[model samples]
Target: MADKDPASVQTDESTGQPEKSAQELVLVSEVLPDRIPVMPVYPRPVFPHFMLPLTFSGEKFLEIIREAIEKHNGLLGLVMISELNEQNYLASGLHTVGTVARIYRCSQVSEESVQIVVQGLQRFERVRVAVREEPVQLWEVRYHYDDRAVSVEELKPHILAIMASVKELLSVNPLLQEQLKALLQQVSYERPHMLVDLVSSVLTAEPAKLQDLLETFDMRKRCEKLLLLLKQEIEVFQMQDKIHKQIGEKVGRQQKEYFLREQLKAIKKELGLEKDDKTQEIEKFEERLKNLDVPRDVLDVIREEIDKLKMIDTHSPEYHVSRNYLNELTLLPWGVYSKDNININRARKILNSDHYGLDDVKERILEFISTIIKKGSVSGSIICLQGPAGRGQNLGRPLNCQCPRT
Candidate 1:
């Protein structure tokens, strides 16, 4: 085709389908070649009529771009790279179908890399890759077009379906509205394939799906496929919007609880509490219990109740009940005590001043103290002062001259 005369271009003016310009016809001949340099990249396959820039920092890729532009008038094919490591992908991940992009502009970004704006001009299928020991390779490709055609009248239904789906998608996802509007302008009323490329350019699916769209040659089927994809996107966007709204509603309902919790936490923190009042209270209890002279069995009971207090929410009604239990526990004489030594003579004088009768009781109390002094260790015993209320009832006051108990 390169040696032959340019193919005659034809179109109808009424449908606004202009004939291919002489410049475009010449570009077409370049793609018919049996061998072309293929740029294997990780980007989504570029559809025809869409333009994007490629940045190449590697000297090899930059040289390839320069050779394609300077030596062959920017004739190159871009295949999608499917592997994570671009080194291996350059050799094995090359997809057979790719776009022929023309580098219309190139800029020297730095000594290491260059940036080039390449517009996808056509879709081509790789017939074979020219295997060589060199890092970069060329491909023998043929220009392929889906010859299966559908009339404009037949494509109207699918196009309308796509329009409705886009509108629905925009309702839930208005962020892309302006971009969609700009892309929609690319839709050609006469050519369904133009609409396919225009819509598919902005609609993001996986790179594989977009690649599938670019490789498709059946113009009408492409539009149908896009419509289905757009509808699926709409459903997904709607569901996401619904879940977001539901979560918002849940947060709204819990606003009071959240506010209360934060306020409580802030107040407790100001008072040197780390979590909540109950938690701080429990921590204080634990710290005190450590230095406290509590019996082992009683300490275990106190710790178990403290754990229960921790499990109870600060907002619960039973929190006070547990708090009351802790208060009762603190009421016990934790470390208080009395000395065993007592002055028998001072006790006899206090008995004479505080009491009138019960001379036998006074004599017996003196005798008991003398006995306790001689014994040196107290044996548990109950001492009762008899007679009237004022006689010797207060005599038990001095009995606590021993260890205090809860």
Candidate 2:
């Protein structure tokens, strides 16, 4: 496998100097170690012609990796962890199909940690576990080649279909378009297998699904899988874009309504319409308060409510509720007092005239009127004339008797 200059550079942590660039070519004819130290990577599978950055901790693990870098020319096997448990990695428990990675750059992160950038060289399958213990986890791996028996002519249609899907993806997914365009410029249709590997690495898919594509050696089958993934990605992007546009339109309409309402308010103020209405309403409330002699505490509350109403938006429901409360408050008879004008004989005569054969009810009302006259007020007292419906209750006879309005 060969590639141009890598897209990223890793700097040494201690020395603060850039590492050597991985611009050299690696041919298939070059010697590769059959047994190599294997490291477990997680979440994503590495594809050939792709670079993955990995972090390692523990002094023993770092030392083992350092020995592999020194003795094996930085060549190692990286396999994805089937389970996410970190303990599984220490036991050399990983998927069999993995990539043969070459260390492109290494950096000392700290005393117990190291970071390395590796470029996948080829697809490899673990033949056997050579060593599985602390500080040493080696695997005997065999490299596999992409099916080359099929000529380029046989893959032209597949290649075209993938490119078309990529184009569709480019139109919907602008965030990844730059990287996709860069990859497109680097890849050629002649190397359909390489294109499939490199392109599939960047596209979004499940790790297991990507691993399945990575293990697929047949060029035609890999192309088919890659095309399907690209189409699915396009669909996801399209759906996401549709949801975003709907949210944007709804927000835009609300903003437009708010803006128009504000503009209308400004126009009305300019024409002396809105300000005059608000001022007139406030003046009417104040006038009512003056006529009724509202209590000082209640006056303060009503004034505060009016102030709040002024600050609130006229189109808001709170404004109307506040205004109605203030109107009711100002209209109440806050300081109005009732006079003790009751006469027991006059009430008895009025009740006797209003109804017949209700002597007991008339007697009770006369006694209540006498109590009011004695107390000088009807405070802490209620006079309820109870009787059956349609009976001569004579609720209006008290008015004729000149009962004080309590």
Candidate 3:
């Protein structure tokens, strides 16, 4: 997939020469409002999509908006607030990197409210927050520049790889696959900014992760982060597919058993030797049960039930009940208790040795033991929990159960 040259950079085909002058690095801080009230777009914290329209309703914010409109180039640092609540907006944890957005349109909705639409241009990092008495906040920002320039040829392979991975991930959903294919085709190579925007739209990442990318001034790092995110998405799809297949097999087995029962009934009616077939099937099931290596107690009960079933008719109630019991017994976990040894001396030594600064834990254990002695006899079992295991054992009879006098 080749990217078309941006309109700004493209030259006349007839001239066969470079068309426009080299684009200048536009510094966005010059036009930005010095002390503008920042209103965070709550739902979309990271600005991956188009410019968002924000309302400035407070007295301080209204004045800031009016000043921005009057200047014809009021730029405000569009920052994301860390926490939003009724009391106050917590902007302390706000990312130092933010876009210096220029106000494009402004309209007065009401006496106190003003609606403003701003277009984000370039990224900036907040350097310092100046102390001020003005209603709005003021911060000194520096232009965070990305000097690395990637040529059109370099980006082609990367863009192609990204498109291929996306297609594979969305193959299960027809609608998403088509939409993603069209999106990849429409990306303009001439405008690297447009390509950046498109990649952001297609990938779904957490806000914190995206913020980390936005803070990065390096384009190479940004592309690497996007690739890593797409790879993670592919892994998620594979895990989901495995889970679906496992569930399907369980359902298939149940259906197979039901179908076999229906076939057996028809076979009995068609054949004249119905009694002989029934006797043979019962004998086969009994042999299989006896061969199974199960505990003697459970095996004895199963043998008795099978003997009773053989005496009853093939279509009798006893025969069906015995079949269900055998199936349940075969599925049970027999003689499978995990062996774990409880060493009281080792446990006590481990608890006291591992932690050097845990005086409270040691004190609590001593207090518990004191209570046990005062009671003459412990009422219930004592559980000594070590890590994941909870070991319980009864204390043997003692000559002196009462607590000793201090």
Candidate 4:
């Protein structure tokens, strides 16, 4: 396809803008050359119908830009560097297919660095290196065009689907609206290839995938690939939204619980009931441990349990279990003692009053009472009684009554 005449008043093919004269077009390309200076960009590939701002510091790149602007009608091949090689100026480092761009504006930032804005014109295939030298390198290239054109009726379904996906994307992501609004306004269903390029430039896909889109000249295939990319983008955004909402809801629930708990505390304080049950229980444990003449280790264990009970939440199951354990510990007769004033006559009278038969058992009990009277303490002695159920096995209760302070 031939380049459009710059002098004619027509819609700008790249931007779809209204009538503009040759002077406004900036670079008036009367005749395009096969061999033009090639500049390599990194990471991102520039697509046609888009403006790319580039910065150059090295004298080599600056020389290339000056030559392209001065002699080649501001036309140059903008190719993407496949990998960030130290020798990026070499032709081998750049992709074979590149965009033919015109220098829209150029300005010098510093003595060493220069900035240039370039608008992509069309796609081109680099045939071979026409010149490779110290200051500048030029490549012979063949221009490519959009192949297999399809009418609006043929692509109506895909166009509508693409529009729906784009609207969905805008609804989910507000940041993209301002950037894509003007570009979408330029989109036309008749120009399917241009629409494909416009959408491809904004996709959050890998550089290789986008570069493939740049290389694809088939109109229908490019649109299909774009549709797939849009669907994948939508799924990614939807999942992100779901995860964000879930996190927000969880945080909101926790905040509500905290607020309610604070309100309850304030209410209890106003009613003079703010001592809290857990605090009162802990204080009681401390008081019991202080009064009882417990052993050193027993006191230490009880104090440790009190500290643990203070740290635990009052409403948890573990808290109740720990409180019950402390209660049992404090209830034990730690230092309570009974006097050793055993009366033989009183014991014999109580045993006769309690049981009628078992004369041998009565004699054994009298002997044990005699032993305790001499020993002064019942240490190292245990009495064992065996009997069937409901057969007077509770004889020990009456025997215990004989002791005055046991």
Candidate 5:
């Protein structure tokens, strides 16, 4: 195995940092008693990377620790375990490649408990796992190191682009901008691998996605992935801005319409067309009804409600008639809707299987499923029911109610 100092790498001139060192590496093999209980780390934890310290309390872990302490080397392999069952982790098989880590610190918390800090060094591929009486897993490991080095001139353009994207994203969020700016300054510009790790940590991708990037041995491929991630972050922020603007426009229109209606009502009362300022604005609605072209049946309903509103005070029953009429007209479906097909029996089965009690709630959910299954889909309709209220409670009607007519 070749032992080279990482600091000897060349620095990127533009960023003033050391370049990445390209050195072929070897993985050392370690033995773990199969009975010692082995935990495989799916995500690769790198050396000098600050990760949450894990506590190993199981009997197998204790046995493994005893052996490591006795051996004096204190070196262990970190392997990624394949999940066999979603709920059970012990049944999963371990992945072959894992980083060989050396214990930096170890402390005994209790008679049966042990705490240790291990720093990962290099990557290794596992050949096989053999069971032993000690309850610890034995791993056959082969080290693979990258010896290909790149100069500062080769990585400047990519680094510049990455910095620009970071700046753009930061402009939208000033707090994040400051943090990113500081990180960029602290990072050595010459070493692309370090930059890759730093950028990948901050990206919006999930932990699993980031792990995949870390496991990728190709330096160029890793940089490409990080750049792509940065581009996606920029696009997401832009889409969010567009959505906010659209919502603002919609709200502005609603506010303007409300203000205009109130002003028109005041003008009508002053001109004596309305009997009182408080009287429902039936005349205004009637004029609007005449301007709008619709089916005869809908027109007839609107005209009838307008006539009723003119005879009643603002607080009378007829006042609600006009309000309802306008609401119904404005809220009608102007477009077609594809019916949703629901399976009531399947829904009932699911509800029963997932929950313990609440028969009424389950029944209501099943009813809704039945409706969707029957009609394929229900038309847009509003149904309100008044229920008993408790202090600080806002319980609405149960969902079992049949759909109201549109």
Candidate 6:
């Protein structure tokens, strides 16, 4: 698609008119306002209730904005450039139908660009365009907006269908979960035409389709078309999600197979059944062993076990046990020691703070700790910790988690 002209930007400059959604439509009476400034939107149709923010450039549009704000107090016209004939933009390039919108804000975004916040006031058809030698265009339009009266009962089924489809779509998409939930709630009490228009804002489709929806003046038909669009969107999203999941699973399976094949290759090389450099495995083992800080006796024992492991056939059951033993040996803290910070005063304070009437236990713990300090070693293998049933009876079992059999 071709880029839209720089003159085609929506602008707004009013505040505190009414609390409404950018998607909520405002009712318009038959009273016709006179000539207003025209803004041609080549991009998308600004449906009723659309509070659209846009960026625009070009000096002609700026002049229109100036006249609209300074003279007319933020009142303007917007006609979408869709399937129209050879009508000149500077002369006549719009339909008899257009919108009367307000400028909520107009800010100079850059030297070449300006941002404008616009809200569609109401539909106005039977417009007469006024061209000028100057870079501005104006429109004299009459407001045209009316919808057939719709009973809530007649709209209930279609509304329920749309809600169900939206819910289903939202279920699969977690990112939209909270935001869509609020939007769905807001759609509940709106009129049928307003409800469909609000939903069109949420579910983006082709601009042409949106133009069709904006042209629909019947409330019942609008709801029906909106429900169909929602169902179609839901089906498309589901199919796309299924395809994505299938592709992901296929990729994962292929990756797993690749990893397994690489492992098998290495294993075959290690068993001297392949042509690859088989010594890399033993080199890796040697490098790992040299980095350890084991006692001399333990180190010698591990080296002898490694040699035995190299000579033995790995298919035997004894191979797994030998491997597990080596793994356990590597994990052991060979020369590590626990340095407990012990002070008699701090210990007394801790004991008193932790428990009342445990003076005897505290004294015994202090005496044992002193003996261990004097010896410069942990002298006992098992020290009984007496406490309430849940406090100490089986607390030390957690220490068993330090190593596992495999």
How would you encode candidate 5's per-residue C-alpha lDDT over 42-108 as one tens digit per residue? 4433422222355677666777766665653666666556455545444456655555666777888
Error (Å) of candidate 1 at residue 135 is 3.4
Clashes of each: 0, 0, 3, 1, 25, 7
Tens-digit lDDT string for candidate 4 (263-305): 9988997898886788789888878877778988988898888
lDDT, candidates in the order shown? 0.73, 0.78, 0.59, 0.78, 0.59, 0.66
The TM-score that candidate 6 achieves is: 0.54
> Candidate 3, residues 271-325: lDDT per residue as tens digits?
8445465566666666666556678888888777767766778778877877677
Estimated TM-score for each candidate: 0.59, 0.68, 0.45, 0.59, 0.45, 0.54
* Model 6: lDDT to the true structure: 0.66
Task: List clashing residue pairs in candidate 2.
Answer: none
Candidate 4 — what's its lDDT?
0.78
RMSD of each: 15.1, 11.0, 18.3, 13.0, 20.8, 24.8
Which candidate do you rate higher for lDDT, 1 or 4? Answer: 4
C-alpha root-mean-square deviation, candidate 3? 18.3
Q: Give candidate 1's whole-model lDDT.
A: 0.73
Q: Give one digit per residue, the lDDT tens place, for model 1 in 116-154.
A: 898876678877877443555777777755332356688
Q: Give the TM-score of candidate 1.
A: 0.59
Number of clashing pairs, model 5?
A: 25
Clashes of 2: 0
